[model samples]
Target: MAIKVKCFASMREYLDLSEREIGIDGIKTVADVWRSVAGGKPMPENTLCAVNQSQANEEFTVNSGDEVAFFPPVTGG
Candidate 1:
């Protein structure tokens, strides 16, 4: 399956690109995909995850059509 990964803030620098498509087995979870694209580095602490625009988790199973966004936790002004 192909999943869309969007990196934000400092995370974008790690990837050096804002977005990319990753192909994975059907059994993979959100965390699995993140690790692969992250060069084996775990997602940053306090990172926010959303699948298809709804909040999700590391264990959240992804589908081919899902769009995932990873962003640093936002703080109020």
Candidate 2:
């Protein structure tokens, strides 16, 4: 299966990437995608995620050609 991964805001800098298409098999959930992209590095806490533009949780299952995005927690004055 192929999944599209996007990093936004501070996540882009932490991941050192903005977007990528990854090919994998037997992978499930947003957390799985995070592990794949992180390459053994720890994922930041409070990271927000979306799948296909809708908010999703870590347990959200991902399908082929699905777009998964990660964003750092938002803060404002």
Candidate 3:
């Protein structure tokens, strides 16, 4: 199965890319996707995730053709 990953805000800087597609075998969750793209590095704490534009947790199941996005926690004055 294949999934599209999008990194936003500081996540883009951390990952050093805005978007990319990855192929995986066997069952995988949102967290797994993050790890796969992270290249053995740990993900930032409090990072937020969404599946197909809807908020999702790390345990969220990822399916083929799904668009998963990661964002750093938002901050405001």
lDDT of each candidate versus the true structure = 0.78, 0.90, 0.89
Candidate 2 C-alpha lDDT tens digits along 5-64: 999989999989899998858669999999889878787778899999999999999999
TM values, all candidates: 0.81, 0.89, 0.88
lDDT of 3 by residue, 19-52 (tens): 9988966638999898888888787888999999
The model with the greater lDDT, 1 or 2, is: 2
Report residue 77 deviation for candidate 2 (angstroms). 9.5
* Model 3 regions lying over 4 Å from their true place: 75-77
Model 2 pairs in collision: none
Candidate 2, residue 51: Cα displacement in angstroms equals: 0.5
List CA RMSD, all candidates.
Answer: 2.0, 1.7, 1.8
The runs of at least 3 residues in candidate 1 whose Cα sits more than 4 Å from the true structure, single-residue gaps closed, are: none
Which pairs of residues clash in candidate 1, taking residues 3 or more apart in a chain or in different chains? Answer: none
Model 1 poorest ten-residue lDDT run: 24-33
Error at 19, model 3, angstroms? 0.5
lDDT of 1 by residue, 1-77 (tens): 58888877877886665888887664367887687678867666788888888888999998886788787776669
